[model samples]
Target: MRAIQITEFGGPEVLTLADLPEPVAGPGQVLVDVTRAGVNYADTHQAENTYLAASKLPMVPGGEIAGTAGGRRVVGLTADGGGYAEKALALEGALYDIPDGVDDMTALGLIVQGATAWVMLRKSVHLEPGETVVVHAAAGGVGTLAVQLAKAFGAGRVIATASSPEKREFALSLGADVAVDPATPELRKALIEANGGRRVDVVLEMTGGTVTDQSLAALAPFGRLAFYGMASREQPSPISAPSLLRHSTAVVGMWLPHVLTLPGDIMRRAMTELFDLAAAGTLKVVNGGEYALTDARSAHEALRSRKTIGKLVLDPSR
Candidate 1:
C-alpha cells in the first residue's frame, strides 16, 4: 500500500508518499480497502504539529474514510491513522454502511464533518426550532453541514460568516438565511440587522481569535456558543470572565474525538441519526474536490490557503 507519511512536523511539503505494508484489522476492527479519505483541517494541523493534541510523527494524517470493510460498503473514523493509504483498519462500530445514494467521497465527508455538525447542533447546543443561529466559516467542511443542519432543525434564521462573497453565496445556497463577510468591520451589526435585530440564540464558532470575540457580541442572552475549531490558526482572544457572567451566555468547547471515549451510546446514536439524515436527502455532503493519494500535500495546501470550500477527499485508487 502507498501512503502519505509525515516523518516530521512542518508544512505540506513534509508529507511524502511512500510504500507501506497493508494494515491488518484487530479483533474488534475491520480492514477497509480505502476508496476515499476525508481531508480535514485537522490533517493539516497534524502535518504542522499545531493541533490541540500532539500528533505522532511518521504518521498518516487522515481521520475519516469511506470504503469496504468485511465486504460491506462503509464509512468510518480511524483513531490509529493510516487513512491516506489504499488500506486502513477501522473499528467495527466506527464503520457504518454507506447509503444507496451516497458516493464514497460524500460518505467520507459525512463521517467526520457531518458527525461534528450533527452532534453540535443536535446535542451540544440543542438548537430550537424558532431560534436564530450563527455559523462561522460557513463554507468550509463542517460549516457547510452545520448551516444545512441548522435549517433542517427549523432554525428561525441562520446567519453564516465567510471571508469572501463566493463563500457567502455558497452558504446561502446551502440554506443560510443570511451570509455576511466576517472580515467586515461592522460584521456583528450586519448580522444583527439581517436577522431582524435579534441576537443569535446559538453560535457555531469555528474561527477563533478576533472573530470569536465578535461572535460573542452577537449572542442572545442565555445563548450557547459551541467553539469547535480554530480555523484562524491563532491564539484565541482572552475572554473577559466578567462579561460571560454578566451576559449569562455559555461558552462550550467541543472536541469530537473525546466523544469516542465517554458515552459510547451517544456516539452510536449520533452516527445513526447522521446516516439517517444523509439517506433521507435531508443532509447533503458537498465534496469540494478529490485528489490522488500521492497529492496529499497539495490537498493540505488547498485547505490551508482557504482556496477550497466544502469537504476535500483523497482517492486511493488514483
Candidate 2:
C-alpha cells in the first residue's frame, strides 16, 4: 500500500509519500480500499504538532475516506490516522453505507465536516424553527454544511460570517439569508445588522480567540453557542459565568472525536438525513480542488493559506 507519511512534525514538506504493508482488519475493524480521502485543517494541525491530541510520528495523517469493503462501497472514518493511503482500517461502527448516486467526492463531504454540522444542529444545539442562527466561517467545509443545515432545519434567519467578500457570497448561495464580513473591527455591529437588530439564537462558532467573546455577546436570550474548533490557533476569550446567567445564554463545546464515544444513533440519523437531502439534489456538497496523494504538501499549504474553499479531496490513484 502507498501512503503519505509524516516522519516528523513540521511543514507540508514533511508529508512524504512512501510504500507500506497493507493493514489488516482487527477483530472489530474492517479493511477498506480507499478511493477518495478528505483533507482537513486538523490534518495540518496534526502534522504541525499543534492539534488537541498530538499525532504519532511516521503516521498517515487522514482520518476519513470514501471507499469499499467486503464488496460494499462505503464511506467512513479510520480508527487511526491512515486514510491518506490506498487502504486503511476502520471500526465497523465507523463505516457508513454510501447512498445510491452519490460519488466518492460528494460522499467524502459527509465524513467529518458533514457529520459535525449535522450533529451540531440536529443533535447538540437543537436549533428551533423561527429562530435566528449564526454561522462563523460560513464558507468553509463545516460552515457550508452548517449554513444549509440551519435553513433546512427551519431557522427563521441564517446569518453567515466569512473573512472575505467571496466567502460571504458563497455562504449566501448556500441558503444563508444574510452574509457578513467579520474582517472589519465592528464585528458586533455587523452581526447585529445582519440579524435585523436581533440577537442570534444558535451560533456555530469554529474559530477561537476574540471571536469567541464577540459571538457570545451577539447571542439572543436563552441562546446557545456551539464552539467546535479554533482554526485561528489563538486562545479563545473566556466566557464569563455571570454573563451567561445574566443573559440566559449557554455555551457548548464540541470535539468531534469526543462525540464519537457515545451511542451512534444520533449520528446515524444525521447521516441518513444528510444523504437523503443530497440524493434528492436539494443540497449541494461544496467540494474544492482535487489533489494527488503525492501532492499532500501542496494541499496542506492551500488549507493553511486560508484561501481554499470547501472540502479538498485527495485521490491516491491520481
Best by lDDT: 2
In model 1, which runs have C-alpha deviations exceeding 4 angstroms? none
The regions of model 2 sitting more than 4 angstroms off are none
Instruction: Evaluate model 1: give its TM-score.
Output: 0.96
The Cα error of candidate 1 at residue 109, in Å, is: 1.5
> Mind giving the per-residue lDDT tens digits that candidate 1 earns over 1-318?
888888998989999988988887778788888889999998888888888889887798788888886678988888487889898888776778887877887787777888888889887888889999999898999999999889988999899988899999999999999888888887668777878988778999888887888788878888889998888886667778887887788888899887777665667787777778888888888879999987888998999898689989998888
Q: Which candidate achieves the best TM-score against the true structure?
A: 2
Model 1 residue-pair collision total:
0
Q: Cα RMSD to native, each candidate?
A: 1.3, 1.1
Clashing pairs for model 1 are none
